[model samples]
Target: MAATLDGLITFFASHHAIRADKVLRDAGFATELASGPKELSPNCGTALRFELSRTDDALAVLADRHVQVDEVHPYVPRTDAWDRSGSPVRRAKRLWGRRS
Candidate 1:
């Protein structure tokens, strides 16, 4: 079964982000590679989107593999059409926990 996209994982480097994508996918977690939102993460330009509900399992998998993550966030992208008259709105809530 495919996992829902509701969480974002930030990395200190693109290398780690890419590796995370592979690790998560291999561990039966769904993931998507997206440009890291500068407002949320300035450490890297790449971020991995994954299932929020399975965050614990996902993090464990990465930790077991010795992969490091800068931060994890609960992200809900704006779905409405952008208004040229104003700045685009983004929804990202930081999740504080053990970082690995």
Candidate 2:
């Protein structure tokens, strides 16, 4: 199967990470600049999270923007309610019908 873009992309520097975030956003992609998971890399403290299916497009935009990337990890974190399935927010959502 082809690779899914449902993963996190690390940067060589925080500035590049920030720029990539902006570039993707400007390109009409919903992305978030999240703390770099130490296990993923120690090169920068920022990582950009976006829809995995759009990884190729996101990477293309980053390259066009000259954003230095350390790595593109095929990581798919728990998306449903996260680790705390019983947290207040999760609980409320579950109570209201949203399981995630």
TM-score of 2: 0.67
Q: Which candidate is the best by lDDT?
A: 1
If scored against the real structure, what TM-score would every candidate get?
0.76, 0.67
lDDT of 2 by residue, 16-95 (tens): 88888888889988877788866677888888877777878888988888888898876555445543532456666667
Clashing pairs in 2: 5-52, 6-52
Residues 6-50 of candidate 1 have per-residue lDDT tens digits of: 999999999999999998889878899998877678889999999
Error of 1 at 67 (Å): 0.6
Clashes of each: 0, 2
C-alpha lDDT score of every prediction, in listed order: 0.83, 0.76
